[model samples]
Target: MPKMVFIETDGTRREVDAPLGLSILEVARRHDIDLEGACEGSLACSTCHVVVAPEWYDLLPDAQEDEEDMLDLAFGLTKTSRLGCQIRITPELDGLTVKLPGAK
Candidate 1:
């Protein structure tokens, strides 16, 4: 089992062990992390935006055009920002930290 760390908008941290290949949004929803998936991972809404820890940013896949388009609508876009719904968890991403962005 692989695990990832989710730092909620209110500063609460949760470590969830999950199988690989599930999106980060799925993991957060499973653990009740309050990550809004307004578009249900469709790459349509920016509601599931989150900031990947700087150290783990390079390890993840590059954001696609649609993800970038949606990110532009996020409330607190940052250099380390990414769409949680677009990030699939993997063993290589274990220990990765994602900060839930403020709601739109």
Candidate 2:
């Protein structure tokens, strides 16, 4: 299992341990975190947008072009923005922290 910390737009945080192989979106759903994956991880929408912590952002693989396209529609895009569904949990991603973007 690995631990993930989610920071809300208002600065609240939730830390939880999740099994390996779960996507960041899945982890949020399991803990009732407020991540809206409108396409249910299908990559069809940008509702699952998250701001990756700078320290952990570099650890994630680069996003595909389609993901980059969807992120363009996200509300608060940043240098380290990423779609939650596109990020899967793995040993290398342990201790990951992401921030939920403000409402669109």
Please report the candidate that would top lDDT against the real structure.
Answer: 2
Candidate 2 TM-score to native: 0.95
For all predicted structures, in order, the TM-scores are 0.94, 0.95
RMSD of 1: 2.1
lDDT of 1 by residue, 12-97 (tens): 88898866999988998888888889989998899899999999999998999999999999988999999998998888998888
Q: Can you list the residue pairs that collide in candidate 1?
A: none
Task: Give a tens-digit lDDT track for model 2, residues 1-104.
Answer: 89999998778988998679999999999999999899998879999999999999889999999999999999999999999999999998889999999622
Can you give the lDDT of residue 102 in candidate 1? 57
Highest TM-score model number: 2
User: lDDT per model, in order?
Assistant: 0.88, 0.91
Candidate 1 has a TM-score of: 0.94
C-alpha displacement of 51 in model 2, angstroms?
A: 0.2
